[model samples]
Target: MSNIKIFSGSSHQDLSQKVAEHLGLELGKVVTKKFSNKETCVEIGESVRGEDVYIIQSGCGEINDNLMELLIMISACKIASASRVTAVIPCFPYARQDKKDKKSASRAPISAKLVANMLSVSGADHIITMDLHASQIQGFFDIPVDNLYAEPAVLQWIKEHVPDWKASIIVSPDAGGTERVTSITDCLNVEFALIHKVRKKANEIDRMVLVGDVKDRVAILIDDMADTCGTICHAADKLISAGANKVYAILTHGIFSGPAISRINNACFEAIVVTNSIPQEKNVKQSTKIQVIDISMFLAEAIRRTHNGESVSYLFNHVPL
Candidate 1:
């Protein structure tokens, strides 16, 4: 660990700083600029020869720019003869296209695989990330990749923020999230419920059906990501209609792409908690019901452990009650 260096791209500079601080080191200097023609250029400011280098960049908005930055940084480090390069991505973008659900549609799992290949081909030694949209995305990488869970951080937030935990129940916004919500329920020693969503025809309203007793119980929705907040908002309305005492949600990444903020603001839930994998936009902060929890500390700790060859599995232990 004599020569461990961490560098951050423009996407999440704050998170990168937290990671550097947790490791008791200063972030390595680097300059990434875009040409007038819009091409990305990256330069390594310090020597990384024979050092273990980690680049922190989120594959969030401006995904292509951020992705290119990471790739170029890796290339720079490799050119400088770094002993190892590890890409630490908090949120993997374009991951929703992990498979081809429709005929004649090109699958973007290859896009994720291409990113992996870009890092590997550009001289990355390993990869560390968290809560991929799909688990099998790991299989696409030839190099060793470790995926961390956001549950630990989310669990802690719930314990501290949501009162009357013992009387709460976990709810999944859709069937796809049932297993994840179930895990949260088991960790908190609460019952689990799921909302069934059926997409009938194009431009038709999707019917939502509740699975378990949610009446008078605090309901917490759990999912990996929230793009538009449509699904969760609809589910929250159903839960409230079914007599739920209160409704809240915890999601890993808040892409907040389209009408996400407006929907979240007017949603039936009491509050929606999301991690700072991607920088929160201004409108998101204006909503009192939308709370942004900093996962910087969690990511920082993971970086520290990885640098010291310590076990990060402890992060997964004892989720909040």
Candidate 2:
């Protein structure tokens, strides 16, 4: 642990601080600023020479600037003779842009791949991120990438907090999340349902068709990310309309941009749980239904194990209590 030096980018210093606290280490010093023209600059305050350097940055608010900051920070650490530099991006930027939108008949860049390429080019020896929008983004990187799951944390929260977890039915807000719902359902030995959504336009749902039974059960919506909360808020209503006794949501990355706060506040969700992959202080304050689960333990342990050359698979199943 002494050989490790963890730094943080501006995107999510709160989460980074928690990770540092869990590891019983102080965060490394680094100054990040912008030039008059808005270019990002980074200066490492202390030497990271011959140490395992981990820079904690999330792909959230002000994403482009944060991404550039991470790239520069990683490059700086490597240039300073750090043994290895890992970018611990809690929520990966441009993850939703992994592939081209087929049937749109227009050209679009695979921005996720572009981000991966940029990371490798920026001297990141390894990558650590959670709940990628598409799993294949791991293949986009040439370096060793650890795509950690928030499943155990979610499980812990449910088992400890939800009194009627036994009466709960896991639900996917959209077809893309069916696999996530299924995995959790299998773990809890519970029934799961899926919601098929028809989109009229970007970030707009035309209609959602609920499949399977949620009647009289506590329907828990599971999703990887919720940017505008449109899908989640609508899915909660659908669950209620399908005769669900109660509706809850669990998302790994709660980007919660635009009207997400107001929608959640006005929606029918008993609660919307999200990991601290991105800071939720403001969102939680604004919406009484929002709950944040601490995932810094898993992240801190991952960093420790990686530095010690130990396995990180145990985190996939063991509930972080």
Candidate 3:
């Protein structure tokens, strides 16, 4: 562990600090600033020669700027003769754009793949990220990639925080999340439900229909990420209308962009449980119903395992606590 160096980008300094502390190390010195022309400048204060380096950066807070900073940091480490450089991205940027837009006459770009290419070209030897919007994005990277899951943490949170966990039903807010819901339900041996959402346009939901029985049961909605949160809020309302006793929304990344805070404050969800994959201090303070679950320990353990050439699959099934 002595040769393991961890540095943080400006996206989420608190989370990066926590991860470093968990590994019994201090964050490596790195200075990042803007020039007169508004271009990004990064300077690594210490040597990283022959060391295993990890750069912690999330896909939030002036996303494009954060991403460029991460790329620069990785390149800096590589150029300094670091043995290996891994990007520990808690929330991957441009993940939702995993595929092209076929409906548009002018096809939309698959920005997710482009990000992967950028990281690799920037000299990133590996990538560690959580719950990518689409798993297939792994194929876009030529380097070794690890896509960690938040399921173990989410399950532990439900058991400890939510009452009647055994009686609760896992739910998917949209058809795409059915697989995630079923995996949780299988683990808890609980019933599962699905909500089919009709989308009118981006950030707008037309209608939501509950598929399975949620009557008189606590409904827990599981999703990988939430942007404006229209889907989760609408799904919660549909569950309540279908006679669900209570509703909770659990997510890996709570982007909470646009009108998300207002929606959660006015929605039917009893509580919105999310990981600190993306910083939530502002969002949590803005809404009483929003709660954050720390995942720094998991990321730290993953970093340790990678540095030691140990298996990280244990975290996929077991809680870090």
Candidate 4:
């Protein structure tokens, strides 16, 4: 622990502070600012030479800028002779573009792969992130990547807050999240459902249909992220229409982009639970239906285990309940 140094970028300092507090250490002093030409400048306020440095920066709010800042910070730490630099990106940027889904389209770059390349080229020795949009994105990097799950925290929340949780059915907003939903249901020893979505075009959900029984039972929709809230909102509507007694959503990253707040506010969901992996916008913060779960302790424990050369696999299954 003495050789561990944690620093934060401008993206989500509050989360970084909380993580540092959990580890009983203060955040490392690093000055990050912008120049007249809109270029990012970073300077380490103290020496990190021969120390294991962890840079905390979530890929939220001004996505490109945050990515650039993280890359620069990693490069700076390496240049300063840090023993190792680990990028602790809570919300990985460009994760949705993990594949070239449209092969016929020209210039269809796998942006996630490019980001991984940038991190490696920028001198990152390790990568730690939560609930990536696509798990396969880990293969894009040659270095070690720790993909953490937020299911434990979410399951604990359900156990504490929801009455008759044992009777509730876990639901996947789309077939893509079947595995994620199944993992939760398996842990709770409950039944699960899946929603099949038809898309008219990109980002346009044409129709959604519930495949399993949710009738008169509490339904908890689980997904890795909720961007624009279209899938979540539409799935909730379908669940309710299919006779679900109540509908709720639990997403690891609440990306609430573009009309998401309005859609969420008008949805049939009882509550939209999300972790503080990405900071909520003003409208999301004000929404009464949205609930935030802090993941700082989970991340802090991972950092501790990594610094101590201990296995962090236990964190994947056990929640601090």
lDDT: which candidate is best?
A: 3
Per-model TM values vs. the true structure: 0.93, 0.98, 0.98, 0.97
- Tell me the whole-model lDDT of each prediction, alpha carbons only: 0.83, 0.92, 0.93, 0.91
Q: Rank the candidates by TM-score, best first.
A: 3, 2, 4, 1
lDDT comparison, 1 vs 3, better candidate: 3
Which of the two candidates, 3 or 4, achieves a greater TM-score against the reference?
Answer: 3
Q: Which pairs of residues have clashing backbones in candidate 3?
A: none
User: Could you tell which candidate, 1 or 3, scores higher by TM-score?
Assistant: 3
* By lDDT: ranked, best first: 3, 2, 4, 1
Show where candidate 4 strays beyond 4 Å.
103-106, 281-284
Give candidate 1 regions above 4 Å deviation: 103-109, 199-205, 281-284, 318-321
List the candidate 3 regions with Cα displacement exceeding 4 Å.
none
Model 4 scores what on Cα lDDT? 0.91
Q: Compared with the true structure, what per-residue lDDT tens digits does model 4 show for residues 1-321? A: 799899999999999999999999999999999999999999999999999999999999999999999999999999999999999999999998887766447677899999999999999999999998999999999999999999889989999989989999999988889899888899999999988898876678988878899889999989999889988888888888889999889999998889889998888888899999988647566698999999998889889989998998988987642
Estimate candidate 2's alpha-carbon lDDT, on a 0 to 1 scale.
0.92
Candidate 3 lDDT by residue in tens digits, 121-177: 999999999999999999999999998999999999999998899999999988888
User: Per-residue lDDT for 41 in model 1?
Assistant: 95
Candidate 4 weakest ten by summed lDDT: 99-108
**How high is the lDDT of residue 32 in model 3?**
100
